[model samples]
Target: MRLYIAIPCVLLALVFAASGIAGITRGWVLPENRHRVRRLRLYGWGQLVAAVALCRQMLFSTVLSDPDTLDPHIREWGILSGGALLLTGIILMGVSQRARGARQGTGTP
Candidate 1:
């Protein structure tokens, strides 16, 4: 069961990492889009942090004494931290998108 869950988590982390790198690289194509590049970098950093947290949790899952239970403080912290990281990454990306849209006159402020 844990293996099944871990596989998906790892895949998700990999996707996040890849997308973040792509965004960071894509930001460099134009000189006038400096702010867009900055926002993209911010979003990318957040996603990378999230990916790291998820990978850390997955790596530590095996050493945990009770994989099925969340009674351990360390395990609980890992879960909560991962959740927080994921949320932060999503929020950064959303803000970046909104800013980009507004700048393009396609979104309302």
Candidate 2:
């Protein structure tokens, strides 16, 4: 079960991180709003952070199965940091999405 979850998490992390790097370095993925450089960077950073948090959560799950192998304090910190990053990333992405939608006249403000 953990393996199944881990596989998808790893794949998503890779995709998001790659997209983030491309967006930050070359602005490759923001085809719809190419003019919004700041928003693009924000979205990219959000994706990167989200990817890291996802990987961290995946690692935590794996470690949780064999709790004796790792320290409890470390696991606690991992969960805290992962949750915080995930939340922050999601918020940034949401803001970007909302801005894009408003610009496109989607009435998403």
- Top of the candidates by TM-score: 2
Candidate 2 local lDDT, 1-109, one digit each (tens): 3788888878989998998888778766656656554477778888888999988888886647577877888888888899999999888776765544446576778
Q: Candidate 1 residues 38-95, lDDT tens each?
A: 4767767666777877787785564353756555777778767867777887677666
Model 2 CA deviation exceeding 4 Å by range: 30-38, 98-109
Task: State TM-scores per candidate.
Answer: 0.60, 0.73
Question: What are the lDDT figures for the candidates, one per model?
Answer: 0.67, 0.79
Position 106, candidate 2: lDDT: 69
Candidate 1 clashing pairs, residues 3+ apart or interchain: none
Candidate 2 lDDT trough over 10 residues, lowest sum = 96-105
